[model samples]
Target: MVDKGGSDTVFRTEERFRQALPDPASMAGWTPRSANAEIEEAPEPAANCGPDADWYCARIARGEANFEAVGEEAQFDLTAFADRSAAQDACRKEKTWSAKYTEAQVPPVPGVDSHAYYRNAGGLDGLNLFMCTGTVVAQVLLEGEGSSLDPATAHSLAQLFASRIHKAAAAQ
Candidate 1:
């Protein structure tokens, strides 16, 4: 497990096999090379046509989809909603969803598990950006996890990480 205390970004793993957790900084495609890394902003392809479409368009127009800085010290704010209604609204606006586990039993965890899974949802070529996140860990699977890692697998990992982090935080 790796914990960035001040940033509150914790990555954990739990398996009966008992392997060491990989370093988050060393994770492939997780770290940015430099402070001057180029930021890219692109429109979401699944265009919505409704009253709220304009609101969504305005958000993208303001470069909300631009890539942010990435580094060991970089902090990615994972905001939590006080209620489901707020969360749903945010999901609708951001085009994201809570990571589902249809293939297996739900794993116990703290906070909320969410994801943005699309076969081809972003960019012109429809690049697949599948990611799953909990309060403790976030995994961005650049290529969709074919059949190797399903939603259940992602959720279970997130749950274990979140549970461990919660326990640690409470102990302090």
Candidate 2:
């Protein structure tokens, strides 16, 4: 049995501690003959074979217990990307020119017709993948468009983008 949230379900029965919680997909993966043979041999009948209130409560308790023990597996910080307003201004100016330059360099991807947009995003772990990708592309434009911002600021921005990608991948 498993919870509606797809967590392992807990059951108390005559087998009690002897029966390890069964994962549905994994159990299903086992030879059907094996599982059916075990079922036929059991002294007690199965209860709550599907997700139910009891299963949900048990799963929540288990997850909360694990969470209390280990904490979230990933973290993202965007504060390091802040306080670069001058760099941002330079980026915006460069973007204006870069758009014209890129438009001139490549016509358009076949069967694709749309203008690209540049946006600045700010936040901590609330940031998403789209924001991270845009920041990296923006960094490239800043460098190529002759921005006056120092290399250190550019490097910091790149680090922020890289860290965001790492955190997202870890979370997944």
Best by TM-score: 1
Q: Write the per-residue lDDT of candidate 2 for residues 1-172, one digit (tens) a residue.
A: 1111111122112231112222233232222211110111222111222222221111111100000002111111111111122222323333444354222121112111212222232321111111122111112112112223233332333344344333322332
Q: For residue 130, give model 1's deviation from the true position in Å.
A: 9.6
Worst 10 residues of 1 by lDDT: 58-67
RMSD of each: 12.4, 23.2
How many clashing residue pairs are found in candidate 1?
0
- The CA lDDT of each predicted structure is 0.30, 0.22
